[model samples]
Target: MTTVQLEHPHAQRRRTLVRGLPLAPAVVLMLVFLLGPILYCLYSAFTDMALTGSSETSFVGFENFRKIFTSDEFGRALGYTLFFTIVSAIIGQNVLGMFLALTMRAGGPVARAVVSAVVIGAWVLPEVVAGYLWLAFLGEDGPLNQILGFLHLPTQDWLFSLPILAVSLANIWRGTAFSMLVYSAALSEVPREIEEAATMDGAGTIRRLVSVTIPMVRRTIATNLMLITLQTLSVFGLIWTMTRGGPSGASTTLPLFAYQQAFQLSQLGYGTALALVLLALGGVFSLIYLRILRLEDGVR
Candidate 1:
């Protein structure tokens, strides 16, 4: 006869702990490399710390937050940041990329290949190099003004006269490739038969797109928006290298503000506080996106 003995509760718990032992090292590495710094930064946000100070730190409550909140420069930076994000990322890149993707999806292979190569080339450039390229392009006596000079058309120094617009345009040109690639993949996954059936039912291109293609790929659109928005919110190198948040802080986004505070002004605590705010904003965006993603899954 074969018999089985039930394990004791303590023994079962020990077995479960042993089973989780392999994950312990990975958990420790993550804590050390990722979560540890974030938590330390958050803790330092409440302190009065300087980049060049002694090891001693003192808590200052919400003084740093209050300082930035009431400062005109911070308010201006926040407003310009929001405007830049909305214009360059949400409107320009997303819309133009979607249009490009749709066009390429239905275009001849040669046209698609050429256009893709051009767009991807711009996107593949390093951020600093792309910033310098745009800087030169928009400078006085550069290609843009030279063309205008040839035609005797009015031309202003683009970067000086329109810093935010110039940077937004540059970002749009560089970033549209990502959104285009995303939409292209999503469009490919869409069932062609549904579109064909809609056509047979006398649906126009716009009608079919509105009622079919968009609905089918709505999840992809939401996901892409979430990713691009977060990325745009954290953009620093391109804006800094090009404008350095110059011309009276016209392009001083949150990240630039943080950098200015931490390294430029030696206000490490204030800068970390700003970083926390950015993190919180990103968290809010992520929550909203997760809800949208869940709803999309449910609908499907």
Candidate 2:
């Protein structure tokens, strides 16, 4: 009986290991497929690694980073990227998302259906398709200008005159749905009993939202902000498809710069350096968000 008991425990351990065996391959695959490229890119960033031309590509140390700092184009692209991130991801996604969530919470089926249809339509469309849609909407003879013409208003070249704003709006339209879904899920999780208690204690709508709702879902807000910011920071195709980083590079973000350098100008090394900088920027943002999450956890 004692022998049987010991053998049963060993058999269970074997069964557990057998069940977990497949996970080892998955983990190894993830490290190889994902971590390998990231490690390679980080290494390449420090060296003058070219795709073509010179057979004598050597390590240039911080020269690439120095060039990034001194370049006027880099400065402008950084500023534009920051502006787009704040405007579209922070303000457009968070604020608009919250508002949509609140409205939907109070709305009837018809209103909910309408809002869902509109937001989800944008969300479900491919990025390239959304880019074309925005291009048509912002073009010289597009619906926007036509509307202005109908109203006897001055028709300006939206894409030319306001490339940043046009692109920002397009990003907001494309991304607001994700934020809306996040906030909606968070809002739903807010306990009705707690809200009722607040109402009974003379807490107004704004007070309840600010104090109770917001605090309760602070983690969700932080998570959504981090995700949207990361996403907006990496945007290339939308801006490229719309403006091609044109109108004198007014709307050029890092991704566009990288593409232009690598493929357009055939400066593969420089482009990879720019990509490394973008990765660093993303890392910094992630750390900030991580700290916030940790602080929230401590508070909780």
Q: Tens-digit lDDT track for model 1 on 71-181?
A: 998888888888888899989899999999999988999999999999999999999999999999989878999999899999999988989888988899889999999
Q: Which ten residues in a row have the lowest lDDT in candidate 2?
A: 1-10
Best by TM-score: 2
Each prediction's RMSD over C-alphas, in Å, is 3.6, 3.4
Residue 34 in candidate 2, Cα distance off native in Å: 1.9
Query: How many residue pairs clash in all the candidates, one count each?
Result: 0, 0
State, as a TM-score between 0 and 1, how close model 1 is to the true structure.
Answer: 0.90
lDDT winner: 1
What's the lDDT of the predicted structure labeled candidate 2?
Answer: 0.89
Point out where model 1 deviates above 4 Å: 1-26, 295-300
lDDT of 2 by residue, 74-141 (tens): 99999998989999989997899888987898899899999988997998999989999999998999
TM-score for each model? 0.90, 0.91
